[model samples]
Target: MPNPIRDVAPTVADAVANERERQESTLGMIASENHVSEAVLAAQGTALTNKYAEGYPGARYYGGCEFVDEVERLAVERATDLWGADHVNVQPHSGTQANMGVYFAALEPGETILSLDLTHGGHLSHGHHVNFSGQLYDVTQYEVDPETGYIDYDELAALAHDVEPELIVSGSSAYPREFDWERVGEIADEVGAHQLADIAHITGLVAAGVHSSPVDHATFVTGSTHKTIRAGRGGIIMCDAEYADDVDSAVFPGSQGGPLMHNVAGKAVGFTEATTPAFEAYAEQSVANATVLADVLRDRGLSLVSGGTDKHLVLVDLRDSHPDLTGDDAEAALAAVDIVVNKNTVPGETRSPFVTSGIRIGTPALTTRGFGADELETVAHHIADVLDDPDDEDVRNRVREDVQRLCETHPIYD
Candidate 1:
């Protein structure tokens, strides 16, 4: 390659270099984000992106897709081995699109959908009013128990019985506890509704057997191939063999056009990695790091949603400890110290989602950078130090030194 883009478009090249510097220097604690391996990056940057594979393997609407078919088939086969699903579709552009594929395959417009509320750790694709899911369907929502910070299965069952929804969604973007998929399946059965579990944040954990698999419980399981799995930027859908043709048709002719074969190649590479022992260790460490983070923050007098975490992320509700502080305040303050995290809405939030009352932190990226419990504990102290006194310049300066040292010690992609 001549690299004319860098020669002619120096400004864009500089921005790309800056972004690489930013990721290499700062701590990436976003729950929905992860750094892909260099191999995955290489696969995603290939010439496969130029192809137009508009249909499933061996049956494409476009020509010259033989290699792309191999990539797609490899992705689906590895995905089946990873999740134990009967069928897998690797073409959805994102997790939201994957959910749409399932909904289109099974439900008609105006059918009722019951899902967890967004403020309680649910995703926007799960029928948020602003998304197409909400606009086209009659959506009802469930909430976590205020007293115990857990899903009330009894309440959910009662509500499902009351509404008789066509589909019931179970999964959360920020939920720190493992879901009881069997119980959710039981509730769906009682209401005569289909079960769709969106495991966008826990795809790797589930693949590694650290979290429960919804493949056996839900009628349809959808997830992002990125996030914890580090499979470039795309989505996947898994279902029974009975719905395979319908799901595939809905994904191609019903919703999207030519597939992103470059991303599919990345998914194939990542899924192959998932079948290894090292990936299992990574998943286990991710959860352990989150546990340490929650404990360290709580010891510093901060309140954690659900009181603690059983997953790879923690939601810190600052309302009880720092009533004057909002999630936005904590996020911006931490970012200034090079400790990246996101503002999030807590259950029964009294503030707007924009400001929020909580910060959601995760360990996948940190773990990928070779972080362990001790390192994460130190990172937690830095976060607590900044949140404890967001206005103090000395505190921020001191935390900045510590963060830079840690980033140097565990330099990513170096």
Candidate 2:
């Protein structure tokens, strides 16, 4: 098939073609990314992109919103069913915007927000100094135990009492273990604070019942549609009926203008796909693959945060094994071999965020491409080999061959 974009814009068509080729050739181990199905890709490219749906279904500020309203309604309904929420908003452009909706609805500006620290497996939107959450709120951070690489509930409780925050955020971007959501809810109750659980990375796991949910414990839940969910790029917010009006208003007028109807249609298609038993099996395999990857890395003498993972990603702290190596060097070495992974900061990190001592590898995209335990084990060894001697061109060449073979064996997107 001739490329349509090639006829109109050759430069953009070249970049798009190159990017698609990159995804097809490389192993995407980045935890925050996954490849959506062709159905979702088609939905996002539809003519619905031309519409402007500014309000919720059945009530819109613009004309000719009936069809776009149906798209948004399907997205909201499927999300509500998947997560079992009293209300769902599928309007926010991204996860950060979804979180902003909750904050705008629940707290006044300059009010307190207690959350996890960024370097300690927490997200920037979780009140880091550089994000809007930190700029507008009195943010206090809690950390994982330096020795065990786990959340210190005792310290968190003490901090909650000391700060008297109006809102408490749960969920993380990098921590390897499952959170004790019930205990965090207890602390929030004791301190009279509302809990916002950001399950951006684990939405698919949570939906598949592979991971415990925060829906019952948190006052609000926010997640990205693109990550583990394999959906179009967007965000979702869920809350009780009482907060539904506030969340809707916050997302619409407070945070953004018209909703992206095309993305919403894509989300609807992905959510429908997620309801199938096959997707549940995929979610389970993703966790199993991560576990196998962690085991292989550990057997090769690398240190994993929390000792291992209970979710879809593993954070490797390289300071103990490769004393001189940095995450940047490892990422580059692996990228050279067509293995894509991101440098990440670990708990008690001494290096700057740009050049951290850790790397976070995930299994979602690989799992989607049909990689199983045996394949992951082989990939893990290749990773360890490169990291063990990144300067060796011979090692890089050998691993590059194996990676290419693997990509050929499990081709994506037909």
Candidate 3:
């Protein structure tokens, strides 16, 4: 059957088709990415996008927002249920914006913000000088222990007291261990700081109870709707009932207007899916697959940050075992054979961020495709082989065949 998109907008249609093919063919191992359901994809493409719901549910600047209000209300309810927050704002455009909303809600300009270092697994919004949070706030960055490759809560507490930050951010993009949220909360409390835990990369893991949640501990929690949650593209902010109004105003009139209601519907749908037992199993399996992959990689002589994983991703420090191979080199080598991973900086990295010494491999997307520990171990062995000899065409060809076989068996949108 000939599609109308091919007839009317061939160029756009071709790009979309190519992306679908690319996703279907490749092993998507990017830690902060996942393949969302077709239902979610359809919901985000609906006519709700045309609506202008500039305010919260039932309180809109524009008229005829009833349906969007319903969607937004449902999204909030589901997010609240999953995350156990007194209030949930499912309207930030992305994770960074969610962090911005928290900042606007809690801190005045020039106030201090203590957070993890970017190279030490912290996110950009946690006070990278290039970001709005840093420009507006006095940013103090912390790092993991140089020897252990883990956050030292005592050290963090020391820094928090020294800085006396107005807000202390606890979260990471590439950290492979679970944070002691309670300890962080204690530091924030001792220093009279509002704790904002941005679980942007592990929203699903936290929601599924695989990771310790910060709802009761932190003053605010921010997350992306997509990553591990499989929600349509957006961000959400969760807060206690006391800060609800401040958070709401900060998100709407303060930073953005006209909520993406279609994405809200998608978030609602994905939240529904996440509430099911199946999603819990998927979340657990993601971590298990990562654990297996880490073991296999370690057996092949690769160095993992923290020596293992407690989540759905592993950060491979290629500096020790593969001294000649930069993360960029390994990323390109794997991408050429359809195993997609991102170049990432390890703790105490010496190279440029663009050309990092480590590669971050994740299991969420592949786990979404039903790749279990055995399958993931096979994938890891293939990864080790590629890293062992990126210059060998025969090795590349063999791994390509195995990757294609796995993709064929576990289809993305069948």
lDDT of 2: 0.94
lDDT of each residue in 311-388, candidate 3, tens digit only: 989999998999999999999999999999999999989999899999999999999999998899899999999999
Which pairs in model 3 have colliding backbones?
A: none
In terms of lDDT, the best-performing candidate is 2
Give the TM-scores of the predictions, in the order they appear. 0.99, 0.99, 0.99
Clashing pairs in 2: none
lDDT of 2 by residue, 1-414 (tens): 988899999999999989999999999999999999999999999999999888888888899998988888898888888999999999989999999999999999999999999899999999998999999999999999999999999999999999999999999999889988888889999999999999999999999999999999999999999999998899999998899999999998999999999999999999999999999999999999999999999999999998999999999999999989999989999999999999999888999989999999999999999999999999999999999999899999999999999999998889
Give, for candidate 2, the lowest lDDT window spanning 10 residues: 72-81
lDDT of each: 0.94, 0.94, 0.94
Candidate 2 residue-wise lDDT at 110: 96
- How far in Å is the alpha carbon of 82 misplaced in model 3? 0.5
In candidate 2, stretches whose alpha carbon ends up further than 4 angstroms from where it belongs are: none
Error at 200, model 3, angstroms: 0.6
Assess the local accuracy of residue 46 in candidate 3 as a C-alpha lDDT between 0 and 100: 93
- The residue-level lDDT of candidate 1 at 288 comes to 95
